[model samples]
Target: MSTNKVIHALYNDDDILMDAVKKVRAEHHHIEEVFTPFPVHGLDKALGLAPTRLAITAFLYGITGTAVSTWLTWYTMIADWPQDIGGKPSFSWLENMPAFVPILFELTVFFAAHLMVITFFMRSRLWPFKEAENPDPRTTDDHFLMEIPVEGNEDELKALLESTGAVEINVVEKH
Candidate 1:
């Protein structure tokens, strides 16, 4: 239930769009979002967004994977049935830990990668069969779009958009 109106400014090139972002931020106007044809370097910084903490989450996931692997190895190899691996069997997991290193590394990487993807999807509101929220389809192909919530001064916003070299500007009302 958004009753706000937004100004969608389209840019022909990412370079120009980036400059527009800087100018808009400098004025203290709130930019709702920006869509780009491709990844633009420093766009996040220009938008004043906080850096992502996914790496930290991934590290935690890796540690969980490591603990799981350790438990599984100890239960299966040492507790249930003990056997000589590489002719070095003291009937203990510590003696056979060298052989488990590869398994630990693989499981850690697997958990980190899969959990990171899932976390990204959940955070972004992206899921299977979910309709995309792209403001303009052209942004996916060759254009960039910046969505700015309109306050009272629509004329001033339009003028600023023009000076920033936006190819097209549209004022849309959303319910």
Candidate 2:
């Protein structure tokens, strides 16, 4: 398989990186990726990327959590152990629902939190023992890295990047 060629531009400041992204998109160039030491506010909008669907998935996970909590509570308290609940003889699940409110809240939050994290990791292709794909390690410290795909316009891209205050530029041939 053939690998893609891309221009990797390094920026010392987030402001410069943001401007470079806007300029690159304005010129109809696609940015493959950007790496930063910390989250850059509104950087996603500047990059013209689509909004994430994680929130929708989180909603579904929350519903699942509520459902599971309801079912487990019913099976454990009302079905098998139809005895003392909340220091009283509970005859129905609805009567004992107030006591289970805290459990319901905790389980809902737990499932949503745990599942959302797992989903994010799976969607981002992050897993244990994976090698880093960052072109430069400095991005993890202070620098920001932007990768632009090369389609035989290396000189033009380099010039544009340099004009946007890129500190370092490299034409990388990756496999």
Candidate 3:
């Protein structure tokens, strides 16, 4: 089996972490991962990550919800069970659409919200009883951690990380 060496640099502040990331990239170092206590604005841009497609998925899911609700309303009110209430006969779906507005809107929102959540969970590969992938527990509380793979330049990388104001730096072997 082969083992890979990586440098883990810990920072106390997000702003400092951001600057360090920029400097690391400027020096042509590839950052493996960054762990932050909270979401850092513009971090993805700084890391050169591509934009996510979750919004597109959400829009498609919402359209699907609207279609399902429309079909359900038409099938139940106009096709399956036609009722005459208050001297008005349910003969056409368009004419009876105003009365089914609440159901349509409710089901549309319900399906979109529920399905979006499920889709997010599935896309993120999250599931119940899954083990945590955190490298440093302190990152979950108040610290920021940047992981960089070592390429036989531990000293140079460590010096650079120290110059970037890393509070703690460690070189560890990852299997």
lDDT of each structure?
0.91, 0.91, 0.92
Estimate, for each residue in 35-127, the C-alpha lDDT of model 2 and write its tens digit: 999999999999888999999999999999998998888788888778784485566889888877887888899899999999999999999
- Point out the worst 10-residue segment of candidate 2 by lDDT: 82-91
In terms of lDDT, the poorest run of 10 residues in model 3 is 82-91
- lDDT, residue 163, model 3: 100
Candidate 3 deviant stretches above 4 angstroms? none
List runs of model 1 lying over 4 Å from the truth. none
Clashing pairs in 3: none
| Model 2 lDDT, residue 160, Cα | 94
Candidate 3 C-alpha lDDT tens digits along 86-131: 7666888888888888988888788778888998899878998999
Number of clashing pairs per prediction, in order: 0, 0, 0
Task: Give a tens-digit lDDT track for model 1, residues 26-99.
Answer: 98999999998889999999999999998899999999889988988888888888877668784778978998
Better of 1 and 2 by lDDT: 1
Clashing pairs in 2: none
True lDDT of residue 153, candidate 1: 73
Q: Candidate 1 vs candidate 3: which has greater TM-score?
A: 1
> Per-candidate TM vs. native?
0.95, 0.95, 0.94
